[model samples]
Target: MIDADDVRRIALSLPETVEKEAWRMPTFRVAGRMYLTVPDDETSIAVRCPRHEREELMAAEPEKFWVPPHEASSAWVRVRLAALEDLAELRDVVVDSWRQAAPDRLREAHPALVPGAEAAGGR
Candidate 1:
């Protein structure tokens, strides 16, 4: 199962990503925009998930995802580390969130990191 360290490793691996601690938790950001956070002692991770897809994701994987009350109005979801299927899934989630927060320039430069792009290759 993925743990806080795994989260740290995966997040920092993203282009232009950085990790900072706030409120006693690790938050991951791309180009100064936060995209992921490990809270509650790193038991789970909060990641960007557009409002349109958040509900469906939670419904489809109730055991793996949820929205913290404070973040309900925001486009974000929390994932239970212990529920993640594997490292590949974690990487996909992290990369997706990174794409959402990454600036246009960063995303464009890292075309392979983006899901659908002319330069798309592999991360």
Candidate 2:
């Protein structure tokens, strides 16, 4: 099953990614902007997600995605690690959040990491 360690591994694999402590938890950042955070219990992750997409994701899969009341106004969503399908799904989700926080130059330099890049022949 995908776990906190898997999250860390996939996040760190991204270009220019770094791990930092915030709110007493581990937060993954790119370009100094936080994109992923593993909460205290390490069972869930808060990731950068546009409000619109976040709502749709939660509505589509409430078991896998949600947001705490305090973070409702933020563009972020909490994902349950156990609900994730596999490591590939975890990588996809983490990479998507990383893309949101990554600078344009970094994204451009790492096209293979971008979602759907493989189908577009990036890899």
Candidate 3:
């Protein structure tokens, strides 16, 4: 099963990534944009998600996902690894987050990733 370490590892795996302080927690970013963040207690991690999917994800899996109190209302969902059985899903979440946070020009330049290249080899 995935855990805090798994979350940290996955976030740091993104290309041209770096970790820094955000909301008093460790946050991962690409080109200065946030993609993933470890919450204060480290029990969960928040990832950037499509605004459309926010409610569905939370309603469908309240124990696994939630919307944080004070940021991007429908664009971020905090996920608890203890409630997630599939690591692939977690990877997809993080990848999507990465894409959202990546610079628009960088995304335009990386055609392969635009279609989610990371999903192909993810576990």
Candidate 4:
């Protein structure tokens, strides 16, 4: 399961990144765009997801994921590591969150990160 340290490491893995304490958590941003949040009290994390994909993701993994309290429907989802055992999948989700928050121009320049991400396809 992914922990706060894991989240910190992953967030720092991306280029031009910084961690700021916001929303009572460690918020990770790239060029001022937020992608991930390290929870203050748990191993779970809040990630920026495509608004359109939020419901689908919650439905698919209701236990492991949820639209964070007060932030549901705002393109943010909180994922609990307790139920999600696959760290690789979590890594992908975190990366995708970073992709969403990244500027379109950067996404284009770094197409290798999120393959087909800027091609207007897949989650």
Candidate 5:
């Protein structure tokens, strides 16, 4: 099953990503902007997501996505690791979040990391 370690591995593989401690948990950042966090339990993760998309994701897949009340106003979503289909899916989600936090220069340099890039002949 996908787990926190998988999240860590995939996140760290991104360009300019760093692991930092915040709120007593591990937060992954790109260009100094946090994009993913593994909470204390390590069963799920919080990742950058626009509020509109987050709501749509949660509504479409309640078992896999959600946000706590305290973070309701934040543009982030919590994903249950166990609900992921495989490492590839985990990588996709992590990379998407990484892109959100990554600076424009980095994103431009790493076009392969952008969602749907492979199908569009990127990389």
Candidate 6:
């Protein structure tokens, strides 16, 4: 099962990522903007999720995805670590969040890592 250590390893392995403590929790940032946060006790991880897609994701997998009341109005979603299927899925989620938070320059520089970069015709 995915856990805090798994989150730490995956998140920190990404490009330009840094781990910092905020609100007594572990936060992963890309170019200084927060992309992922692992709350105390580490049952789950919160990451950048487009608001338009959040509800559908939650509906699709309630056990895996959720919205913390405080974050309901924002473009973020919490994912239960235990619900993840494997490291590949975790990497995908983390990469997507990282792409969403990364600057244009960073994204461009790391097109191979950003989801849909090649699909979107980005080289």
- Model 1 TM-score relative to the real fold: 0.90
TM-score of 6: 0.90
Tell me the TM-score of each prediction against the true structure: 0.90, 0.93, 0.79, 0.83, 0.92, 0.90
Report the number of backbone clashes for model 6.
0
Q: Model 2 residue 31 lDDT?
A: 87
Clashes in predicted model 3: 0
Residues 21-118 of candidate 5 have per-residue lDDT tens digits of 98899999988999999996999999999999998999999999999999999999999999988776787788899889889999889877775444
Which parts of model 4 have CA positions greater than 4 angstroms off?
115-123
Candidate no. 3 TM-score? 0.79
CA lDDT, every model vs. true structure: 0.84, 0.87, 0.76, 0.75, 0.87, 0.87
* Per-residue lDDT of model 2, residues 1-123, tens digit only: 878999998788788889999889999999899999999699999999999999999999999999999999999999999998877778788889988999999988977876534322532
The backbone clash count of each candidate, in order, is 0, 0, 0, 0, 0, 0
Candidate 1 lDDT by residue in tens digits, 1-91 = 6888888887898888899887887899988899999888678999999988999999999999999889999999999988988877787
Clashing pairs in 4: none
1 against 3, candidate with superior TM-score: 1
In angstroms, the error of model 3 at 23 is 3.2
> lDDT (0-100) at residue 4 of candidate 5?
84
Ten contiguous residues minimizing lDDT sum, candidate 4: 114-123
Q: Please give the distance, in angstroms, between residue 77's alpha carbon in candidate 1 and its true position after superposition.
A: 0.2
lDDT of 1 at 92: 81
Give one digit per residue, the lDDT tens place, for model 4 in 10-103. Answer: 6687666799988777899988988888775866888887777888888898998887567865878888877766656666777788888888
Which residues of candidate 6, in runs, are more than 4 Å off? 115-123
* Model 2 TM-score relative to the real fold: 0.93
